[model samples]
Target: MIPKKLASSLLIVALALPGCGLVLENRIERREAAAEAAYPSEGRFVEVAGRRVHYVQEGRGPDLVLIHGASGSTRDFTAGFMERLTDRYRVTAFDRPGLGYSDNVSEAYEGPFNTRSASPAEQAAMLHRAAGMIGIENPIVMGHSYGGAVAMAWGLRHDPAALVIVSGATQPWPGDLGLLYNVTGSSLGGAALVPLLTAFAPEAQVERTIASIFEPQEPPPGYEAHIGAALSLRRASFRTNARQVTGLRPHVTAMSRDYPALRLPVEIVHGTADTIVPIDVHSRPLARQIPGARLTELPGIGHMPHHVSAGAVVAAIDRAARQAGLR
Candidate 1:
């Protein structure tokens, strides 16, 4: 009973949809190429269980391992933070699996529609194996933001000498992570929308996001260039990061119960003004959970205390080393 004109329009629209998808996929690939070329890997890789993990190692004293936050790579540390510690301790900064140059924890998680992510424990174990391969033993482990959760998992499951959490997301927050994570982590968004973002999300918007993460303070000159924000925009990294962050709360909630059992030296540094992971919600409660944990509160600093207040972070690390008898 349909009119010929209406049927023709429907057919045309249906035909165009596939063409549009092809165009978008092509754009995504090109953008990924551009990003990779602009910010090539700056470190070596170690293969663990058939997957590659990228890391930058420097310094020569006691071993120290650094884990970066969500949407970050080892570049987050090499962007100057590592330089501060290289004189005192042997440092290794790792690109957590799926971000930066590292491979996803599993090939199955690389599919666009798949929403599963590597848990903090799994990430810890994989990185620990890589550390063992590198001959790093009883190193002090430090994590920033999302990396903090992985560091905590490392402390619990492995035998790190000490731990330092810089603006870490260690405990479960009260609310959901909002629309960006909620949507991008869903199956439909991961499949249909991530390509569009990969192709079209602007660099200015990324700069603004970087600025916001350092709010109440500004990113140091050249920080944007060195951090390589675009690297996280690739389709697989974007999907994996979103899925990991969205699914993190349950894991952190489960991990909280084991904090009291940890006997390692623990040092936590957080900015009072940090909106990304509030001091009251994460670091303060975290300091209370672990026995003999030291908490340093940086007033007027935001999420990036390691950059803005590098001295304090380094001091905390030194304290942790001393407590663990590494200093």
Candidate 2:
């Protein structure tokens, strides 16, 4: 017989697992079905250095370059920011090399495999070329998560109107990471983990993940359908991103020193309660690093404020633009 306390605790733990997956996989979910809904944002690929890069264009105004994080595509930008700001600005989102519709720079990557380019610096260069190919000049470039590194790298080269980092992994901050995260996010961490989970992870698990990510948001209608779509995103991004752990984290460490060199007006938004990409790694340190940067922290909010607090995200972007004289 199950002891009452033991049974109660076990039940609570069982209920908590799904929620954990969703919260951890925000970038994954953002790229899946939710992206497909933003149709006619359309797939437009261009040749850059003999590589095929996928991109989406929307609206008209000063150009806005939105870059997605690791294991993500332009979809994150299209859904999270572009669709919302289209009326006032022209937004362009792209699939970074090795992810989504974008082709790999080298069919054979060296040493490590990853959803992102070898270095954040390289990813930013590719993005710069992509924008130039599409006629977006000196646009406001915004990056989230790994994309934040790319955005900062790009800003360093070109004089942009402004730069925005959202829940961005600005620099490595210390924290407790569960074994599962290390296995999923670390380079050479493990190979069998993905295959094992993909083969055995259940639909119920995916659904619970969705609920957990949204947490207090109350899963809206047709949410379950969205969760299933996320599963089909092809585990390549996940696998590569898993190995990208060491490659990208080191980049973050080096980038911290270079932050002060960026003269363009900058803004960073972080959630107080963010579990991933801790607030200290980015918002606070970055604000201090950049001579005149502004940091905004959302109380009780987690990493993806775009979902938990849409209005605040919008306001932050607009505020950053205004501060930089973008209007």
Candidate 3:
């Protein structure tokens, strides 16, 4: 009964849909191949709450747990920082949920809410459970950027000996994460456009994006190769990170209100030149709020203090361990 013109249009769309799906599948395979080639898992996995959580463990002393920021893997610490901590502490670095080699726990969240991805709090719970599996008791929990938010969540509910926040997005920002995150985080864009980006975005573009995150200072030599930036380009990782970031504001707002209850030692390291997670907006106010919290400002450094200013981060950890009476 449909008009001839409309029937023809429907047929055209139906034909195009399969072709588009094929293209997406081809893209996904290529992207996944690139990810595996560049960053094969360098850590062990433990089944935590029905999901395999990837973690890197090394050294022998007081336990220390490292959580990488959004879109980063355990390699973020293995690149260089973990060595510094291993000499005095057993360092275990984790890839946040839905990132790197860690299993995506979005659907496995225990809460009553229906959500596609794990929130920061849920991620903290999963990682904390992973820690328990490995016998990490009251370890110093450290998080950078988005991972910092999860660390705070852990400290609020758990009994971490100390909390170290490095360039953490502790406070909620006022506005959006610009156009890229807004569009990619939405359901429509995530389903339609993420595959195209994963399929064909040039490696140069990915390199450029990583460089920008370490702004005010060029990425350390061989940084691109060591960090496995391609892993971040996978469609699943891209979509999960976009969702985590887009939904972060309210979570940070809710968590920050409970900052006072975190009575354990807290060490915060931030860069004055960090435009990504502005120091003034997050760390400074955090230092003022947490009683006896210490804030160390890295002059002229950008967002990645763990890379650019390794000694300061180590010192903060030392101070925290000492304060927690673990050293």
What do the candidate models score in CA lDDT, each in turn?
0.90, 0.65, 0.84
Candidate 3, residue 288: the lDDT equals 90
Candidate 1's residue-wise lDDT over 31-85, tens digit each? 9999999999998999999999999999999999999999999999998899999
> Quick one: best TM-score, which candidate?
1
- What TM-score would you give candidate 2 relative to the actual structure? 0.77
TM-score against native, each model: 0.94, 0.77, 0.92
Ranking by lDDT: 1, 3, 2
Q: Against the true structure, whose lDDT is highest?
A: 1
Clashes of 3: 0
Worst 10 residues of 3 by lDDT: 106-115
Model 1 residue 126 lDDT score: 89
Q: What is the lDDT of residue 54 in candidate 3?
A: 93
List where candidate 3 sits over 4 angstroms from the true fold. 1-18, 108-115
Worst 10 residues of 2 by lDDT: 1-10
Better candidate by lDDT, 1 or 2: 1
